[model samples]
Target: MRVVLAEDNVLLSSGLKLLLNSQGFEVAAIAADACAFLAAVETHRPDVTIVDVRLPPSFRDEGIRAAAQARRDHPGLPVLVLSQYVEQEYAGRLLADTRGGIGYLLKDRVSRIAEFTDALRRVAGGGTAMDPEVIAQLLARGGDPVEALTAREREVLALMAEGHDNAGIARRLVITDNAVHKHIGNVFLKLGLSAGDSGHRRVRAVLAYLRRYGGNAPDATTPHH
Candidate 1:
């Protein structure tokens, strides 16, 4: 995938550029700050953008905010937000705007070159690759909104958040479609939400799940994954 690299740290940025280059990804442009990063995206329109969550000037949520802006400007564009820590708030914000081709993980996780490249490829292909640490942290923060759900229902909810629909969730879980539907209903009931509330409830459930896991929103630097 064609990629735009954004990071305030020059040394790490260059190393990552070289690594991705060797892996056959074209480093379309490199930027040391959020403004330049946006400009690079406009100029290159890369298939994927791997950006550090912090950047020049204020060095705060500029990168995360920029990533969200890029998604808004270019729907379906793949964006992998690399951070030093897990920020549940940032992740929630990203998901609230769009669910396609987005990722959030710690920067150190990139040291496993093959895994990182594979994640990039996945996002470029229109899939999500959230850091397990982020997921785990989010899961630990608060009470599972679906905690009252039965085991099967919880299973369905987990798969659903993973972007699996009823059919897919059923198939993966080796259950019949009828069973999946039943579990889904149970989930909705347990969460005390109605049919028309699916979308809102889904987002709420996710947010709740993140909170239950002791996850905090994005700070300037989150040491999550």
Candidate 2:
């Protein structure tokens, strides 16, 4: 897939371009500032954009704002937000449009190339790829929104937030597809996300997961993969 990368760090930008190229993704454009980033996106219209949360000048949230504007300009544009911290508020904004094709991950996770690339592919293909640390932060702050679920059910829901379908969840958890379905059904019921189509319900469940634990704590050491 073609990609537009927006990061202010010069060394990291070069490294990411090389890494993405090695992983079969075309780096269509790379920019170090918000305006340049938007220009690249407008010019190349890449399949996905990998963006840092900060950028030149203010270096606060310029990149994310640009990404949001890009999505508005071209609805459903895929974006993978890379950040040093787990910012739930930013994540909420990214998903506010409810159009999917979005991801929010900590920058350190990129070192796990296989998982990171898989997340990029998933987001590009119209799926969610939230970081486990972000989920953990959300979980730590929320009042156990999913406390009704059994351990296995919680596991299934967690995998769902990681962009896994029934088949993938089954493979990872060593469960039958039927069992996965049953657990997911129970999850939806418990989370009050049963009112929509399966795809919509999945997105709602993920959103619920995020809002339930939308605390501003530092990320946990736990790995989601």
Candidate 3:
């Protein structure tokens, strides 16, 4: 697959280019600043774009801004935003777009070559990958951003990520089916997803869950969420 990489760190940039090349992935373009990054995407229309959250000029969220802009212009191109630390707010912004094919991972994860490469492939295939640290952060504060949910509701969340349905979650957690239903209600309420269509609620909830704990998908064990 073709990729456009954006990072201001020269050593890391060259290292990543080499790594990707050795792995047989074509490096279609590379940029050191957000402006150049966007221009390259517009020019190359690469299959995926790997971006560092901190880039030239502000050295803040330039990468994030670029990712958001690229998503706006291209609509379906995959974007992976790398950062040194987890920022829940930033992850939320990325997930809010819900166009599929977005990722938010820690910069250090690039060293885990296998997983990082897989994440890029996933994003290119229209899947989400989030950093584990971000997942732990969201799980630690699992509740309605607007309202609090019960412990049972949180348990239901953990089970949802486990690929459980109301019946399955009820059985696994030893709760009544009705109880699981109520917990689902509370989850939707707390997450401010109550008004969405029924068919899409579960997907949205999963997106919220991933947005919360995604940086860690390379590892399945739910971090202390």
Candidates in order, TM-scores: namely: 0.71, 0.88, 0.71
Show where candidate 1 strays beyond 4 Å.
149-225
Candidate 2, residue 84: CA error in Å? 1.1
**Candidates ranked, most accurate by lDDT first:** 2, 3, 1
lDDT of 3 by residue, 1-225 (tens): 899999989998899999999888899989999999999999999999999988999898888998888888999989988888887778768767666677778888889998788778877887667665654454653233523655556566655533345786677777799988877887777666653655435546766655664423222224232
RMSD of each: 6.0, 2.9, 6.5
In angstroms, how far off is 91's CA in candidate 1?
Answer: 1.6
Candidate 3 contains a number of clashing pairs equal to 9
Best by TM-score: 2
State each candidate's clash count: 16, 1, 9
After the best TM-score superposition of candidate 1, give how far the Cα of residue 136 lies from its true spot, in angstroms.
1.4
Worst 10 residues of 2 by lDDT: 215-224
Encode model 1's per-residue lDDT on 1-225: one tens digit a residue: 799989989889899999999999999999999999999999999999998888889888999988888878888779989999887777766655445677777889899998788778877877666675665455443354535656556555555554445676667778899998787777667666564555334434544444444443221112112
Which portions of model 3 miss their true places by more than 4 Å? 142-203, 208-221
Local accuracy by lDDT, each model: 0.72, 0.81, 0.74
